[model samples]
Target: MKKMFAVTALVSAFSFSNVAMADEDIGCGLGTMVFDGKSGKVHKVLAATTNGTSGNQTFGITFGTLGCDGTGTITSSQKLAMFIDGNMDNLARDIAKGEGETLATLSEVWGIQDADKIAFNAVAQENFATIFASENVTSTEVLVNLNDLIAQNEALASYRI
Candidate 1:
């Protein structure tokens, strides 16, 4: 009796959750594809359960399969932040020197074309003190300062992410 009651409670919870969620709340997964366009509590619960248990959601997110957008994992700004965080020392050195592979990579990350890379590098070199600003400046601070500097540069303003 107790086991049956627990099962009933769990099912009830799932049903209530279905009501609370929007119609498209199941998200992209094998379950969503399987139960596409279906409605009601039972279908919602089954779809939710399948998506949660099968690990297809993880696969979908990683590989851009199962109707998931490939670009959902990280925004462009996030990519810039991660790159800056990982390559801070190299970036600083390159910025200070006004040219290096890392600095070139940074320009690429901002989608600056080859034609404008010279201006980008020049801006970075010219504003190195403003970008670094302090001995303990953080990656986030560096990104903000870099974006600000880029925005101020007429040739590289469009490249600011």
Candidate 2:
């Protein structure tokens, strides 16, 4: 019984840690909006469960209801950061090349219009060294650097997160 309890506790700890480290927010939904300012394990769990069980989160994301933006698209920087984190290698390569599927997808994620894609790609390729400053550069650092680069460019300024 003691061994079983220990194992369960270990699993629970891992689960909680993963959730705590999640890049995205609880998400836009009725439950999330209702519990927005509340902080605590219990409130978080309740909000998450309510969003998941009621399926309101999906509904909100799709229809842009509740606190969700009406674009039916990824409107959160956290989600964009998560995407960059997951695709760092591909993004680095794409950015370095000035054009690729990953880079194009990232532009889309940033809501960059087709007219500005050339400028966006050009800026990314030109500032590859700055964006990926070091071999150990992290996703957050990459995002910051990329945003800074975008801000410096008049054509790409509006796309800066």
User: Against the true structure, what is each candidate's TM-score?
Assistant: 0.56, 0.57
Q: How close is candidate 2 to the true structure, as a TM-score?
A: 0.57
Candidate 2 local accuracy as lDDT?
Answer: 0.75
Per-residue CA lDDT of model 1 for 19-124, tens digit only, reads 2222244666556656767888789778867766757667655655555444646668778887887799999999999999999998888788999989888988
lDDT of 2 by residue, 34-112 (tens): 5767887687767767666656667655655545544645455766787788799999999999999999998888888
Q: How accurate is candidate 1 locally (lDDT)?
A: 0.76
For each candidate in the order shown, give its overall lDDT on alpha carbons.
0.76, 0.75
Task: Identify the leading candidate in terms of lDDT.
Answer: 1
Which candidate ranks first by TM-score, i.e. highest? 2
Poorest lDDT segment (10 consecutive residues) of candidate 2: 14-23
User: Candidate 1: misplaced stretches above 4 Å?
Assistant: 1-72
- Which regions of candidate 2 fall more than 4 Å away from where they truly are? 1-75
